[model samples]
Target: MTGQEAEELLREGALTVEGRIPDASNAVLYCSVSHQERSAHCVYKPVEGERPLWDFPDGNLARREVAAYEVSRATGWGLVPPTVLRDGPLGEGMVQLWIEPGHHSDQDDEGDGALLALVEDEEPGPGWKAVGFAQVGPGRTALLVHADDQRLRRLAVLDAVINNGDRKGGHLLTAPQSRLYAIDHGVSFHTENKLRTLLWGWAGEELPEEAVRVLRHLERDLSGDGELAVRLAELLTAPEVDAVRARVAELLRSGRHPVPSGDWPAVPWPPI
Candidate 1:
């Protein structure tokens, strides 16, 4: 289904919880939402199921997830799947269309693996960008690398603007038609800089032209009484909204991808 159609199903359909996702820290439910003749699987995270985090306020992760979707939609990249906040079986929460992982295409750019991989060589060869060295065993280390694909580059830019704090490798999903989607954005949009991620391959590189244009568009959409600004104000604090605007402005000013600040952990633990 198209993004709009999926969004409509999520918002207007009757929802039923199918089962719980066991691996998630917060309660994540596998569900099916149906409206008239259409139906699809979805993931729902209710506000009441959220575990308290020391850094973020309580009962706000669901809103932050939807806020990430709004920014992703504004970029016109569709990096995030269609997501919405509404009352579910558990309560008010974030619900997003489920994307099944597709088979690897014959045209896979990363060649041997998905977006990320580890190699014994210290440097990442062609078609790859080095993240850093990771310890594998007691005395062995492998070079961590990510694909040099434009899609991942755009996601890196998106993570920067959103202040995404936990962009683990597993969050990257390759759906059918080679569409790339990023999920699990609960710890995002903080007023402080907390951009911990595994996609630092483009650190210090000049921003892509498309990304520059997108950032310019975001600047307008986030300034004053712009539509995005108005919508985000309903989901996030005033300072968090301001911080997003500031991040976009900084990207425009720098014209380059950001490097780790060193004040906080650069990569999330267990990067995958």
Candidate 2:
């Protein structure tokens, strides 16, 4: 669906709470969203239901979620699911299209196996990068891997540009056609250096040509009077928006995947 259609549905849809997603840090609900005749399965996180975080401002997570989608769309990567901020049964919140795993295509039969293998460390062979080792069972050590998909690599670049602070393995979702979607972006776009992710495989490597092209476009879009800058101003502080512009500029200048700065934890806790 087009981003505009998704946004309209999320804004005008009737949301019915199906249930709570167990173990979610915040009160995330499984919901069915309908607008007119169109309906979509969605995940909703109400602002009131958000757990207080020492770092992020209260009542702002929902906006941040929408901001992430905007940035993803601005980059033309479509890394994030369609998301919108609106009032829900629990009050104002963020609603995002739910992506189901195991969706397949005629061209790729691997389905969600590649993603699962990355998380489960079940012989995620070539085209995957092992970031660290995990204890899977008694006396058994398993490798923690990330898919080497170009789309995911672009997402890694996007994460750096946004200063994503929580990019755990669980946040990566596999959609149909083997597309990877990044979620739970409420802790992103901090002015400070707060990037934490599982995609360090391409560190210090030159960004692929397509990624560089996207960054160049993003740099232009973050400048004055650009659509991205205007939209971000509504969701983020002026200084935060400037920081995003700075990040885009930095990426365009560096032309390579960034290495960890060593100030903060390089990876989020509980990688998966």
Best candidate, lDDT = 1
Instruction: Report, for every candidate in turn, its global Cα lDDT versus the true structure.
Output: 0.91, 0.83
Q: How many steric overlaps are in each model, in order?
A: 0, 0
Q: Model 1, 172: alpha-carbon shift in Å?
A: 0.6
Worst 10 residues of 2 by lDDT: 103-112
For model 1, what is the error of residue 65's alpha carbon versus the real structure, in angstroms, after optimal superposition?
Answer: 0.4
State the local distance difference test value for candidate 2. Answer: 0.83
lDDT of candidate model 1 versus the reference: 0.91
TM-score: model 1 vs. ground truth: 0.96
Error of 1 at 155 (Å): 0.0
Off by over 4 Å in 2: 102-109, 116-125, 135-142
- TM-score for candidate 2, please give it: 0.90
Tens-digit per-residue lDDT, 1-272, candidate 2: 77788878888999999999999889999999999988888999999888889988888988888999999999888989999888999998999998774442111235425543435545557777666677778998877776677876888899998899988877876665557688899999899999998888788889899988998888888888999989999999999999999988888788888889999998889876
